[model samples]
Target: MKLRTCPRLQPLKESIRFLTRKPAQFSDGSRICKRTFAGHTTAQQACDALVYNRHGHYDDVLQLEKVLLPPVGDEDLRIKMLAAPVNPADINMLQGTYAILPPFPAVGGNEGLGEVLEVGSKVCDAKPGDWVIPVDAGFGTWRMEVVCKATDVIPVAKDIPLLSAATLGVNPCTAYRMLKDFGNLKPGDTVIQNGANSAVGQAVIQIAAGMGLSTINIIRDRPNLKELKDKLKSLGASLVITEEALQKPEVTNLFKDIRRPKLALNCVGGHSAGNLLAHMEYGSTMVTYGGMAKKPVPVPAKALIFKDINVCGFWMTQWKRNNMHDLSEIKAMVAELAEMVRRGQLSVPTCTQVPFPDYKVALDATTRAYSSKHVLMME
Candidate 1:
């Protein structure tokens, strides 16, 4: 891969190894003292971030580099990051496969939890003690601190677990929106999803439970299926079945009373999705968010032509942009979801936190089909 120079990152001859003791200057021509650049200081100081000067392999390009903290603007807030999850989307972005590419010399995380360290003099939306998540996507949350507009951060309750708070901004938000936006699902209606054990799927299970909806969860066959099924059921899943079992009459009989699922949340496409469409109720909708199977949604023409089934797509990034001008709705949604978390109605996705120095472990975990979410945590 060709290494590209960052116009903004001049003066530093070496791209990856940053956060040095020398009095290096920033893109804005402001000097960052080494003491502050060391980052373990108070939130008012500079910090190090997982950055890539040019997009390529994450292990090759991503490095912890010192960054001058953006000055708190009139309506800005300074956030000290607590945790950030290493998601498939984060991997995709690192590999330059995501739809929205960050400009050169970009940071890596999208969703994470941060404590409000300091707010600009003119800010009022958030205070110093508040816990917040990104108001939109692409906040580069895998860092020590971030300073953004006050409105760019949505305050969440600090009482919840750090892992859950760290993840609330992405998978959970995606599940919540797909469950709401694509279909007019009512209480007791069944919503089937393939990646039922995934972070987003877990969020869908709990959120659906809170809304009085039933979730027909589908996961790939594994030796510990019962344990996984019990775990999802404890979170209020009405039914959890492996993709192979989906073809059996016994599974269909279980859903007889509930009727066929009216909504399908597809993350793993290909045949995993085909099974969902085959069992969908007439006039229902299937919203595809992820393609874990890395295959197309092979929907039968019969389903579309006769069953009147509707297929749609949901991306949290696009939704954020569409509602950027008006985020009151999402802010309220986030608050409600956080309450579910605080009350124990929602269980945070199983997670393993890796320290910033050991980020190679976290980055490697993303490419594998691990059951747990890998999070990057900074002390």
Candidate 2:
């Protein structure tokens, strides 16, 4: 039987022949074909396309390359990433030192704000066009899109800026868990924390204040200590003092008039932790989250034995996975904090937003900025 080809089929055959002979034409024509095809078809029918990737580390630069989009599974949700913060953990991931190590040629970014472009058949809670924040750590949030388990993505407030939502997974959650779970904080109680100028620390201050708990913040000596102290105090800190002042004998009497703090949050280990512990009352608990100095915390035997001081550690990822109650509390706290930010009651501090175009410069700035304060990277 002889098959007759239509006039439209003739041109398609010619174009295919031309593309077969000169593959470069195929590359050039693919975009036009893709656009036309996309206009005619729905997203579910289209194949996954290339996005972004980091191949390896060359000097300080993350060797980024464009690659094919990842295939989504039945339980996965495909997200179009809008913003991801360049947090300290992201830098650590690049250095191959972070606790969570993603596979090589992997994307790096822990927290990101994204829109669900598509979800597999089994994905019930997520839907296309829903703005969501990734709940999992080190899920390659740096890329323009990602495929993750639907359970790993959580819906976020639409009114919140994508930048703010991008940072929702880590610091704020850490602060919430540390304050509520480890501290067992009650209304009208007081909490003390070193690294009080950190993002987590600042969140703790705001959350504690909003929860009717006062804060005693300890920060390093900065040129603008007075201004920093005043700013922290404005954020519901009952008192703000330098680490040097914490070592002074007068610290005991300092909180005599104020509510004695039952909980102390320590991010800075070593001698700094000892100073924070000294300020805590008998039977008070101190939770160490991060060791920024990379030094071990030295708890005085007297405080542990005689004063009944409890020294504990908090890792937000592990805590969230292990304790459902703690996770629920964290979600509630984030909602409360988001409301506060909306109401202009909680401030995120002055952050320098770096555009994606200037990411390298911003990364360097973030490294240096860590010396003084937390540097928030906005993508």
Candidate 3:
């Protein structure tokens, strides 16, 4: 297919889609047209290039166009995205259900891992070839490349798996913050969490185990509970129980040797929240981070007053913004997690990579796979 052009789109044509080639096959059977750089020979000549948003409604899937790089001033670095993960939040944002909204015609992606292709003269901390992740929450990350203030990118180890790094930012951060902030767990303390098979839940189990804390993980009964329990236990969970089991008196009796949990993490609301709260001891806290059931957290006031229990909410973006100084520390924790992956001490559940051309099919498959493990789309 011949490349099409418009009279008013000169800068876009010059910067982004200059060296267009025929769409080629990807490993997953998707096809993507390759883009080439021209004009500037050195990194200095490289302009910001991206999958531009021409126009669309909130319900529409983003129609990406190859456009010229946007203008960059002082203190900016141009980054080429390697991969971006598709999270439930990203889906919610596309559907306009998220609290934060991006401007129209903006690229759509929350988290990605990229390599710096050029750096502003004033940028002292980062340079070309450094692998980095975004520090800003809502900045568009779906494009092939972007230009942003140097301070917005957090440098990461180049050796880390780029796909894993792309998937790390939001969910893992949520898990880490919720456990550390609300739970105040000590080495021998036990904590209970619902949605134990979720990305954040899995992270909680792993991180809690790594910190010498035991996890009483509760998951909804699936067709294959044995497989699920075995998987979670391998990640260091002390025990994996079903929501139905919580209703049984014998299950609570089994925990007589362990302290009444001081913390409970609830992402699934509705009756699940009540079920999770039942396992917590008096004077403890329950942190609700999400409502996957699309229902309000229903906890008996008696549990609060009589038991002295506290319930709170968590949003990672807000935490990061207010606690910017803790970012370096958070990054160090992630790096340590990465090292654990290298040493076979930690592992994420298996994910299937779908091709970009099969996005529609992939998206449907992803929605269905939500009950299983994570689904990743790659070009």
Model 1 regions more than 4 Å off = 1-44
Candidates ranked by TM-score, best first? 1, 3, 2
Candidate 1 residues 1-379, lDDT tens each? 1222323222222232333433344332223334354534444556778876556798788878767775666777777888888888888888777776655456778888899988788876778879998865566788887767677667788888888888888888898998887779888788999999998999999999998998899998888888989999999998888999997877768766776889999999999999899899999999999999899999899999999999989888777766767778878988888898889888877988899778889988888874478998887
lDDT of 2 by residue, 251-362 (tens): 7787777777899999989899988887787899999888887899998899999999999888776655454333455456567657777776667545556555455654
- Give candidate 2 regions above 4 Å deviation: 1-61, 72-74, 323-334, 369-379
- Cα TM-score per model: 0.88, 0.79, 0.81
| 1-379: candidate 3 lDDT, tens digit per residue | 1221211111112122233423331111112233443332333333222222322332365544443453454677887777665566766666556765444334556777778988888888887999888765655665566677666668877665666677667777787778788867789998898999988899888878887888999998888889989999989999899989988989877588777789999989999998878878889999998898889988898998999999999987666656554467757756776676666555644555544433444345445534443333433
Q: 2 or 3, which is superior by TM-score?
A: 3
Higher TM-score: candidate 1 or 3?
1
lDDT of 3 at 341: 60
Against the true structure, candidate 1 reaches a TM-score of: 0.88
lDDT of 1: 0.79
User: Who wins the TM-score comparison?
Assistant: 1
Best by lDDT: 1
